[model samples]
Target: MIKEANTTFPIHPLIKSRWSPRVFADTPVSDEAIYTLFEAARWAASSMNEQPWRFIYAKRESDAYKIILKHLAEFNQQWVKNAPVIILTAYKEKFNSGKENFHALHDLGLAMGNLSLQAQSMGLAVHHMAGLDWKKLQEIFNVQEGFHITTAVAVGYYGGDPSVLPEDLEESERAPRKRLPLNTLACEGKWIEQ
Candidate 1:
């Protein structure tokens, strides 16, 4: 069920093909593939090489998976429950020198981008979700003082019945992918309101 993006300009096939899907097959992603995804993330460029991104991942049926699922917003839990893998992402608030790293979130985004592309290349789907209890996760995991929980992700092989989703979600699942035009997104030398 590949919903390849209908791009106005040519782009990398992987970029064009990647889209977050709520529906995921029950097939489990292999351990090696999971590690490979992280390996791709590990190489993402970071601010001052701080590499603040940190991830805690769990396969379906694991105790950690249940704990994560329990914290997700009800809406997310409804769909995410079918995913074979779940991951929590966090970033360090400060560098080793105790200085604030304001770009930590941006760096974490870069890492996630790398991971998503890798997953796409391997015929896997990645869905990032912000609807979670991050503060609770921080306490539950006993994360270090400077580390802040950011987002959660669902990963698994694509191909699940959209009919299983709620009416609104099922419509969304089957709808054509859409994005803002490039002109609205990028501007030349200066900022111009579209």
Candidate 2:
């Protein structure tokens, strides 16, 4: 089930092997593994050492898990139910100096990147979703001001019956992975519209 990226240039094996899956096995991710993933995120580079990222996670069997599922958009709820773990991501909107931290979300993304790669290394699958009711989550969690909810993530071991998904999603699950060419993404010292 390894959907390794077909890259033009060689890349790290973990990066190549990582792909988000809508289906996840029923196996429970170990607490140790979860801690390890966060440990990796904890070391990611942040602006001015203001590691603004915050996470609220729940195991599938927990009541909190149900609450999170309820807040997700209908489409995400369809597939995320099978995940062993659900995580809510957020970032502080302001620095300790009371100034806006424009890079808060960017730093949060770096942290999630670290977590995702760590999950891949551990033989787990991670899928990030932006389709959720963030305002509800904020209210539910009583997240104080200056912190903004960003996204939700599903984590678990891979291998589930794609056939169980709706026809369209099943097709998407089985589709070949594709990416834009590097030339279109990066150029020398100038912006080029492709």
- Candidate whose lDDT is highest: 1
lDDT (0 to 1) per candidate: 0.94, 0.92
Model 1 / residue 3 / CA error / Å = 1.3
57-83 per-residue lDDT for model 2 (tens digits): 999999999999999999999999989
**Model 2 spans > 4 angstroms off:** none
Clashes of 2: 0
Question: How well does each candidate superpose onto the true structure, as a TM-score?
Answer: 0.97, 0.97
Instruction: Tell me which residue pairs clash in candidate 2.
Output: none
Worst 10 residues of 2 by lDDT: 1-10
So what's the TM-score on candidate 1? 0.97
**How many residue pairs clash per model?**
0, 0
